[model samples]
Target: MAGSIEIAGLGKTYREPVLDGLDLTIGGGVFALLGPNGAGKTTLVSILTTLIRPSTGSAHILGVDVVREPGAVRQLIAATGQNTTLDEYLTGRENLVMFGRLRGLGRRSRGRADELLAQFGLEQAGPRMVSTYSGGMRRRLDLAASLVTQPAVLFLDEPTTGLDPVARRSVWSDVRRLADDGTTVFLTTQTLDEAEALADRIAVLRAGRIVADGTVAELTATVGGQRLVLLDHDGTEVRSIDTDGTAASLDAALGAVPDAERALRATLRSPTLDDAFVALTQSATDHQEAVA
Candidate 1:
């Protein structure tokens, strides 16, 4: 069966191809598209959200073709871009209620606004003008506005781009709660930490194509297995030895370390998403250069 968000042979071109023969399938959960700048992440979101049509290929949200039935697709999905879409002059609650009314919620708009304000932990700030809200608060309100209609799929394009660590984690919690509630969140971000923290599955886009796709552990394993690191008394890394994460491999690595007792301690470290991302994207770049 097709996933909640499906793309087949997806391509988009402007002067040059931004997305090339892309294909992806995301089931109901937090699915992240990770890539560097100009990797066609926003282009894909635009196509899927019906903001723009693709040059080729098909995209569907919950079985509704975005190209053929954009109106239907719009009803099933909502998107929050990098910039806030809330009205600064209006109260947080007012912004949500406005969105609700735009969605034709009628008298239920206020009720839904209250529900979202409370859900996003903005009950206290809901009555204040958006201009007075903190960056994090505004972001939460923007997200809440997107959920006023309870979309099946929520597209978040770099949801936490310019926030401090605390604020980013706050948004991360909100996203987790939404996914837990069965909302299929399609998140696009360049930050590896964000993807590692939020995504149930991640696809790495390089240039215009997906180079890797898998769970966090799976992608990390692609770069390499566990590593054994020797640390000095000051907690500085003395040496790093690569291992296959097996007992025999670790034993061999340790046996090869000269004067191992001199080291204060040793630790096993697994390959992180950052390692996988750098390795995968660099390999893609090398391959593209060779092809050219």
Candidate 2:
């Protein structure tokens, strides 16, 4: 277990309950927490990062009890929140060095920070005030700050919330790099595509509880309907199918078009992660409504 997180019967409430006995366990490697807004994803991140105490239950980071030994857990984890809190007056490089110093890595070289600046494509912006940096640049710098300590675990809350495609892609590369270096990455994002691309496994959180948890393919296969695909080798100018999917129905449709056999091929594949997200979120919404 290079880096591990075990949350059991975790609960949180502020006026109304946010979590209800949510449980999760992860050790090492990149894991994605996928959810929509108001789904308690941030709440889970806050507690797991030791920013706040849970209402009940226990959470362990790197085998250290978060509630009983917060300091020790903090030592093993770093979080890059959605909001970038870089000092406006400080240059990007200055901020990174400041963080590295705070981590008590003073004697250690800041050559790593310089390399990170270049790696994040912020070399030109290194000397500029955080106020002068673009949203994407500041986001990258915030992420860079988190890596100064080389923590065992890193929590990223929607790391690409406010970035362009190019900048977001660059940030994604950095995330992969960190995971490759043996850092256990806990990420939350609204972009299903992002989760599917990077996460070795994904846990869907809704109403502060994990409604679905598994590898992208596994979760998709849970609620994802059997996909029936028809390949038209003729490259027909127009093609359509009935909305209802049934073996008998498809067989009838194919039989009616027997003459088109040479140009048509049909196959079935399981559902995709995108479909799982929608299904999980919708189910959560229904649960919330019933609770209310």
Candidate 3:
């Protein structure tokens, strides 16, 4: 069963507040959390996954209160952290089988193990010791192990952080397939490309608050207007400007260039997700700076 997430006025405090007054609702699909280090991305994940308690407010996963009944919430979700946790002594198949049994699959464990092995493209490597697997392979096995119980929600923290392009794409495919099959995916990533490619909706967290949250296009539009891409014919220079195309805005953009009339080409385009992220985060920073 897929689930929706509801967090209301959630706050966690340690030294200072890690997460403060966060209120958000995430329905079924890929919900990506984009943030820099210490931006409360992982903290939010931990609270949602029942790994930690909130100091104030409440959160519910599929109507189950995360704080009031963490055990029940745990039964409905699986989380994979930044690091791998597989036993190197075990073979790929053995690891899956072990995890399946731990989840109480019992006699069905072997079949589930085979299914995951095939699903992750590890059928040929299933019998090899996990120590022999490469980084990407190990990550895939770790993810596959998490799915043994087929939880309603899956939290993947930095799932493809260290992967090469090919391996990253492979993980992307698996995530898409899971979401297609009705598992609500909550992802945290520092990679903008990963969030843009995978998230059906994204929320950018900064300084213990959500600076921005929406679909990629919606967030981009909120930052104001179209972007002008200026590229040199020799491919030596590329600059982008975000503006509403007002006379002042256009002039300011052009003024930055030494000779706008001599530019080889310029294209007026809609702002990308990257532009929205940077602009919104910068705006938040500026606001905090002014207050300080």
Candidate 4:
């Protein structure tokens, strides 16, 4: 079974505060953390993964206290950071085998290596040196290496940073499969599209705090309701209006415009996750600037 995460009053600091009284509860599913650069996403991940200590408060992963039982928490979780950690001199298959060996897989190491290679669609390139692999291939190998023991909880920080569309979708498929099999996936990514597509829930981090947390629909509704997009007869840009999800609101918006009769088409659309992210982060930034 996968694990749940509980954090309360978590705070971290160095020359400046990174996280401040952050509280969260994440269960067995894909939970994505979204934030801009320097929003303390990496700091939170490091603290939760047991790589760094929190300045105050407490955290637990899979019911194991992160501070009190770092080793036990480490045993239940796997992490793949933004940077590549694979050895360029080693083959993809060899890397997996090496990880399995390090994890004490012993006699079953090679079998486990083969399984991950096949699972990640790297079987054909298993024998190829990591130096010869492309960026996407190396990413797959890195992720495969992290899953050598099939951890109950997985932490991925920007897992698909440089991947192409097809490769990104490939990784997304793997993530969905892992979650379907009952693994709790904690992911941080800059791509709102990826979060919208993969995350069962999302939390927006800003200014060392979680500004918002919920399903995509819930978050999007916070910025505003749905939207109405209109196109002109010449297929040129017309206007987009924030809507209240009522047919009357849509009609009123279009009706209020002088060129309503000349409109070629009108579409009522729900605000996208990206829209919510922008609105929330911008609000956070504006609030900070005003206070400063």
Instruction: Report model 1's TM-score to 2 decimal places.
Output: 0.84
Task: State model 2's lDDT.
Answer: 0.81
- Model 3, range 210-278, lDDT digits (tens) per residue? 988888878888867766667777753367666686878877766655565445577677767766777
Is 2 or 3 the stronger prediction by lDDT?
3
Better of 1 and 4 by TM-score: 4
RMSD of each: 4.5, 5.7, 3.6, 4.1
Predicted structure with the largest lDDT when compared to the true one: 1
**Candidate 4 whole-model C-alpha lDDT, 0 to 1:** 0.87
**TM-score for every candidate vs. truth?**
0.84, 0.83, 0.89, 0.86
Model 1 lDDT, residue 194, Cα = 97
Cα lDDT, model 1, residue 201: 97
Where is model 4 more than 4 Å wrong at Cα? 1-3, 228-239, 245-267, 284-292
* Ordering by lDDT: 1, 4, 3, 2
Please provide, for model 2 over 141-184, each residue's C-alpha lDDT reduced to its tens digit, 9 standing for 90 to 100.
Answer: 99999998788999999999889988888888889989999999
Local distance difference test, per candidate? 0.88, 0.81, 0.86, 0.87
Report the lDDT tens digits of candidate 1 across residue range 80-115.
Answer: 997568899999999999999988899999999999
Q: By summed lDDT, which 10 consecutive residues of candidate 2 come out lowest?
A: 235-244
By TM-score, the candidates rank as 3, 4, 1, 2
RMSD (CA, angstroms), candidate 3: 3.6
